[model samples]
Target: MAKDNSFDIVSKVDLQEVVNAVNQAVREIETRFDFKDSKSKISFDGKSEITLVSDDDFKLRNVVDILESKLVKRGVNLKALRYGKIEPAAGNTVRQNVTLVQGIEQDIAKKIVKAVKDSKIKVQATIQGDQIRVSGKNRDDLQNVIKLIKEMDLNIPVEFVNFRTF
Candidate 1:
């Protein structure tokens, strides 16, 4: 009997890395001459949102750039962040919120399943809550599916996990 090979596709961000990134950004802002006297700050809510505050639009953009660089250096995918619109805050400051994405959205999960089914690969794909599981009797077919998914422009960062053969 041929046992199935399987893997899971998921999109998740490491919250601790995000926190570290924010801390690095804050430290950079404090030392930068332009931000020395300006009110620039980055704060993380520890759950899913990061808040950025600066004295004006220019400083706000600079703050965002610093944060992004730190995140990239930490190997955190930029796609996992959803940036909210910048808005005016108290004391003539500008503020923005960045929401961390933790899972594959339902619509995207459905699209992944449909694409797998349409590809004519000898595999079965099922959407299980926030992730997709793909399984097949042939290990090669499973690898092919992974290649196909990698070639797709899903607009979200995905990681393949739990590769198993039984």
Candidate 2:
């Protein structure tokens, strides 16, 4: 009998890179002419949360844009950054929470599951928490699944791990 082949597909963001980007953005806000005097600031709380504060919504948006640019430069996908609703603070200030969403969202995850099923590959796909595991009897079929997935424009980064042949 042929050995079973399998691998796990996961979508995860590196929190350290996000922290570095936030730090760089804060420095830029401090030195930039328009932002320097706006009292806009950014801080990372906990391991994966970023808080942006500004006097006005416009300034807050500017800070977010800068942070997004920094994230892009660091090869971080913008989709991974989930922004909370902006609200007024105690001092009539606006603040927003930028949470790093490392897991695949439900819709995207379902789309991936459907794509894999539609590919006609002889693999069984199961949603394992935030990731997907694919298994098949033939290694060649498993490789084909990987290749096909790569060709699709999922608009998200996918990492293959936990590969094993049973």
Index of the highest-lDDT prediction: 1
What stretches of model 2 exceed 4 Å from their correct place? Answer: 105-107, 147-156
Write down the worst ten-residue block by lDDT for model 2.
100-109
lDDT of 2 by residue, 14-109 (tens): 887888888899889989999755768899874778899998998888888999999999888886777899999867789999887777667877
Report lDDT per candidate.
Answer: 0.93, 0.86
| Backbone Cα, N, C clashes tallied per candidate | 0, 0
- Model 1 per-residue lDDT tens digits across residues 53-109: 999999999999999999999999998989999999999999999999889999999
Write down the RMSD of candidate 1 (Cα, Å). Answer: 0.7
* Colliding pairs, model 1: none
Per-prediction TM-score, please?
0.98, 0.83
- Please estimate how well model 1 matches the true structure, expressed as its whole-model Cα lDDT: 0.93
